[model samples]
Target chain A: DAGITQSPRYKITETGRQVTLMCHQTWSHSYMFWYRQDLGHGLRLIYYSAAADITDKGEVPDGYVVSRSKTENFPLTLESATRSQTSVYFCASSEQGRETQYFGPGTRLLVL
Target chain B: DQQVKQNSPSLSVQEGRISILNCDYTNSMFDYFLWYKKYPAEGPTFLISISSIKDKNEDGRFTVFLNKSAKHLSLHIVPSQPGDSAVYFCAADRYNSGGYQKVTFGTGTKLQVIP
Candidate 1:
């Protein structure tokens, strides 16, 4: 109950449908990140927020959007999901950019 | 291109033997290295980390060694146990030219401790 958490541990959606993955952390870390893990690609950062309302893109950010209105919440949204977007998403948090990150349980999404 | 790489996709070792996992990075800017372990249906958890200034860092049965000159790092698990069977990831951290601190992870190596 004290660490980070992700909602909808498993999700199935149709292509072109909008879906959102929620991430919450009780640590109130300044840095929160969203990463997608796919076969052969490992974990690629989609977006990261340094603090409330300040976010940046990582290696892959297209088709995905993220926002951080509260320090404890960072939610990722897919305006129109595609089959290619099917993968496991992980949310991580750190006190600062240089600190060690703690990850959440992850959300598995299947876009058909 | 993959900046961080784990050449071995999987490793198997005897329960009582030592297990070694290797990782290589193409970026010299990476100053902090970390190792994470993950079990099925779970997020990866931090196991050990070492700063660029140190060649090695140890925590209980897990030890991480960094060879800055070679741009390589390794994780050694002594007296490996079945519980250690999981996916191990090697990650690197650095402040990029864009002024944002970034962390990159390797493809991951699945370690199996056979009894």
Candidate 2:
């Protein structure tokens, strides 16, 4: 519980279904981020939170939603999962702006 | 548009040789750069980082060189080891209005250090 962790390391779901990926960190970092990695797109930021109750969209945030109700937890949800959404999702946290981030083990999602 | 780009999809080098991975970025405003290494089933872990004010940074056997004019950077691992084989991603960063840094990552370059 000292490092960042992502729940449900692997998940399989059909298109149009909703799925949520959970992330928790014990470092109490003020900055948390969610990213998705694909074959040709290394790591695309989906969303980020600066602090509890303060979240903002990132480059690839069209189909995903995120919430940060607590400093230790940030969850991402796919409103309508699509085949294109199938990719490895990573959660990262940093102490402050411009600080190096520590990543979670990642969640491998498959949308059929 | 992809701001950070790693043109080489893969590279192979013999152990004890120098392994170099290149990256380029379109954005000139990026203030910081970082490299992340990822394994088959694990998420990426931070390897090295360089600030825009410096041209080079080194740690142990790893070194990162930055060229601001060319918007290019490279990571060099001397005497590469077989255990060093992994996918490398280059990322550019800048502090956003949200009081957090925003990162743009490259497609990644897979390096294979053969023994």
Candidate 3:
């Protein structure tokens, strides 16, 4: 509805396959972020976009790719998914500054 | 090297008691701190935040205390209820010289409020 939403709440894919997680925010926030949550490690930022066409890599960005062609949408793509990529993916959006963020329900991905 | 750390992996408290979750950070440049609560199969929602300049910030039953000298922050929930059971994550906002802002989150502490 009015908040952020992620597509395919649950996904199962094979290793080496490509998977893309979609994130859409209705609030029209200027900053969109992608984070992955694992067991020992907390939520690590994968990528963040300040505005349309402006993106930056976060802590763990080696295996992930992101693009923000539109302000309302930011998609994360895994070129070659591996078993280590299996984790809960979250999408968040915020205003100009990177202070408060609203998160989506999250997408659970299992790479077999 | 983890910048943010939540030493307590899990905490249990009886209902109507106080629940304390602690977080520590190694970066002194982090100016802002925030706490987020996440339920199973759901994204984390912002709970509360306190700037480095302030020692304490409170909202209703939730209060966040920041100790800048010790580089520690804590979230205290009074009169805990079952609904308060969730994973709480503490995040630090760091602004780099490049004019970019980044958030570093701790491993998270799972709190179970026994009702």
Candidate 4:
């Protein structure tokens, strides 16, 4: 597809384990972001990448790690997953500085 | 603190009626606002937006009104239809510390239309 896509639409992992959520965009956008959506918290930014190899923390980046080695891909890794990390993860891409973000289908992760 | 707030959790309206969804912001630094609609299992789609300079922006059945002084904005849908049933989100864009545009989104409001 030409738009952004997230791998493992649904995932189940145990606490203390490591998990990585993948995001790939075909538009070659310069900005890629990772957000987690929960019941009360709409969409809190976990991490954002301005360009390849340039990533920064977002609102809720405590337990999440993100890296962008290519313009088309931005993956989020949970070093040590916890129950608090169980939420729907969304990946989005924009042209440069947050003009408009196009989001992926989302990855539903459950921690046991 | 939540910069963007959507107080209504859900709203129900009859077809062909007016549907109004309101949003409030605590930060005056936000210069841009946008509304997005999302369905289950799908990503949110852009609905309408209004810049701080403009008070109102309309597109088809969707219209967005911005009140800078009150730090409030609203999305109004006229002659609402059943197809408009979905979750609507309000977002604000502010200049972050690093000079990048930062977006903060509201919890979202679910609208149900009865035909």
TM-scores for chain A over all candidates: 0.99, 0.98, 0.97, 0.98
True contacts kept of each: 0.77, 0.85, 0.87, 0.67
Model 1: runs farther than 4 Å from truth?
Answer: none
| Per-residue lDDT of model 1, residues B69-114, tens digit only | 9999999999899999999999999997666678999999999999
DockQ of each: 0.82, 0.87, 0.84, 0.76
- Order the candidate numbers by DockQ, best to worst: 2, 3, 1, 4
lDDT of 4 at B98: 87
lDDT of 3 by residue, A1-112 (tens): 8999999899999999999999999988999999999998989999988889989999999989999999999999999999999999999999866579999999999999
True contacts kept of 1: 0.77
Q: Write the per-residue lDDT of candidate 2 for residues B1-115, one digit (tens) a residue.
A: 9999999999999999999999999988898999999999998999999999999999999999999999999999998999999999999998776556899999999999999
> Against the true structure, whose DockQ is highest?
2
**Higher-lDDT candidate of 1 and 2:** 2
Better model by DockQ: candidate 1 vs candidate 2 = 2
State which candidate, 2 or 4, has the greater lDDT. 2
Per-residue error (Å), model 1, residue B39: 0.5
Those runs of model 4 whose alpha carbons end farther than 4 Å from true positions after fitting are: none
For model 2, the stretches where C-alpha displacement exceeds 4 angstroms are none
TM-score of chain A of 2: 0.98
DockQ agreement of candidate 4 with the native complex: 0.76
Clashing pairs in 4: none
